[model samples]
Target: IVTVAGNVERPRNFEVRFGTPMRDVIVLAGAKPDTDRIIMGGPMMGYAMPGDEVPVVKATNCILVGSPTLFPPPPPEMPCIRCGECAKACPVDLQPFEMYWFSRAKIFGKAQEYHLFDCIECGCCAFVCPSRIPLVDYYRFAKSEIWAREQEKEAADTARERYEFRLAREEREKAEKAAKLAAKAAETKAKLAQQEAAKAAEGTAAPTPTAGDDAKKALIAAAMERAKQQAAAPLNTENLTPDQQAQIADAEARRAQALPAEGKE
Candidate 1:
C-alpha cells in the first residue's frame, strides 16, 4: 500500500504492486502544479527524491511533495551558542551541542566517546537548535571519519604484526645456526681429545729396553764407578822421595807405551 500526500490534488492511499515507479504513483495522485520536490517518506524524517524516475521499494510508505509554503529551504547554518535546546530535544538524551562542537572541530575521537553513533540522526536536535546548526549532518560526518580512521589503524596493526613476526623468525634462525655451529665445534674438540688420549695410551704401551741397551747402561755405570775410585785415591806421590818419584814416572811411561799397543790390537 502506497500513501501519497502533500501538494497533490488527491492526498489518498492506493494499493500498488512492488517495483512501482514513483512517477506512476504521483500521476495517480495527480501532482500539484506547485509541487517542487518529492520526498520518499514523511516531511520530518523523509529524504527528498532527486528525480521521480526512481522506483518505489517495500519501505516506501509515504511519498510526500514539497512546495514553497509546505517545505521551504532550510535556513543558513549558524554556530552553536550552547543554548542546550538540542540536548533537551534529543530523544537519546545525548549532548548534541557538544557533539556538534567536536564534529565541527574534527575531534572525532571525543565525539565517539560521547556516544555519537548512538544518535539516531532523528533531526530532533537540529529542529530545536536555536542557531540552526545541522547537528545531524555533523554527527554523520564525524561517524564516517572515525570509521575510516579505524580501518587505517587496523591495516597498520596488521602490518606491524607481520613485521614483528618476521623479525622473530630471523632471530630464531640465527639462534638455531649458532647452536648447530657450537655443537659441531664441541664434537670436533671431543674427537681431538680422544685422538690425543689414544696417542698417550700408545706411548704408555711401548716395549721396555732390550739386553743390548742394558749392556750399554752397565758399561756407563762401570766407567762412572772407576772414575769415582780414581778420584778417591789420594796423591801419596806429593810426599814421596825423589827416587820414589822417578820410579813412579818410569812406571807411567811404560804403561802409556803398553796402552797404545792394546788400542792397535
Candidate 2:
C-alpha cells in the first residue's frame, strides 16, 4: 500500500505493485500547479527526489508533493553562538553545537569521536537553531570527508604491506642463493682434498731417515722427557738458610693466632 498526499488534486492511498514507476502514481494523484518538488516520505524526514522516473520499492510509504508555501527554502545560515537549543531539540541527545564547530573547522576525526555518526540527520537541530545554521548539512559533509580519508589510508597501508613483502622475498631469495653457493664451494674443496690424499697414498713413498733427521728426533725426545720430569719434580726446601726458616716459622705463628681470633668471632 502506498500513501500519496500533499499538494495534489486527489491525495489518497493506493494499492500499487512493486517496481511501479513514481511518475504513474503522480499522474493518478494529479500533481498541483504549485508543486515544485516530490518527496519520497513525510516533509519532516523525506528526501526530495530528483525526478519522478524512480521506481517504488517495498519501503515507499508516502510520496509528498512539496510547494513553496508547504516547504520554503532554508534561511541563510548564521554563525553558532553556543546556544543549547539545538542540543535540546536533538532526539539522539547529541551535542549539535560541538559537532557543528568541529565540522565547520574540518576536524572530522574529533567530530567522529563525539559520535557524529549517531546523528539521525533529523534536521531538528537546524529547525530549532536560533542562528538558522544548517547543522545536518555540516554533519553530512564531515561524514563524507572522513570516509574518503579512511579509504585513502587503507589503500596506502595495503601498498606499503605489498612493498615490504616484496623486499622480504628478495632478501630470502638472495640468502638461499648464497647458501647454495657456499655449500657447493665447500663440497668442491672437500672433494679436492680427498683426491690429493688419494694421490699421495698411491704415488708417494716414505723416504728413509737421514743422520740429521735421526739427530733431530733424538733431541725432540730428550726435550719431551725433560719437560715430563720437571712437571713431576717436587719443590726443594733443604737448601733454605737458617734466617729464611726463622721467617717462615714467624708467619706460621701469626696465621695460627688469626685463626683462633676468627673462631672466637
User: Which prediction has the highest TM-score against the true structure?
Assistant: 2
lDDT by residue (33-95, candidate 1, tens digit) is: 888889998766678789988888989999997789887778998877888998999999999
- Whole-model lDDT for model 2 versus the true structure? 0.90
Where does candidate 2 stray beyond 4 Å?
A: 1-35, 40-42, 53-63, 205-265
Lowest-sum lDDT 10-residue window in model 1: 40-49
- Tell me which residue pairs clash in candidate 2: none
TM-score of each: 0.55, 0.62
> What are the runs in model 1 whose C-alpha is more than 4 Å off?
147-265
Residue range 126-241, candidate 2, lDDT tens digits: 88998999788799899999999999999999999999999999999999999999999999999999999999987878877899999999999999999999988876666788
lDDT of 1: 0.89
Error of 1 at 182 (Å): 23
What's the distance in Å from true for residue 166, model 2? 1.9
Model 2 per-residue lDDT at 129: 94
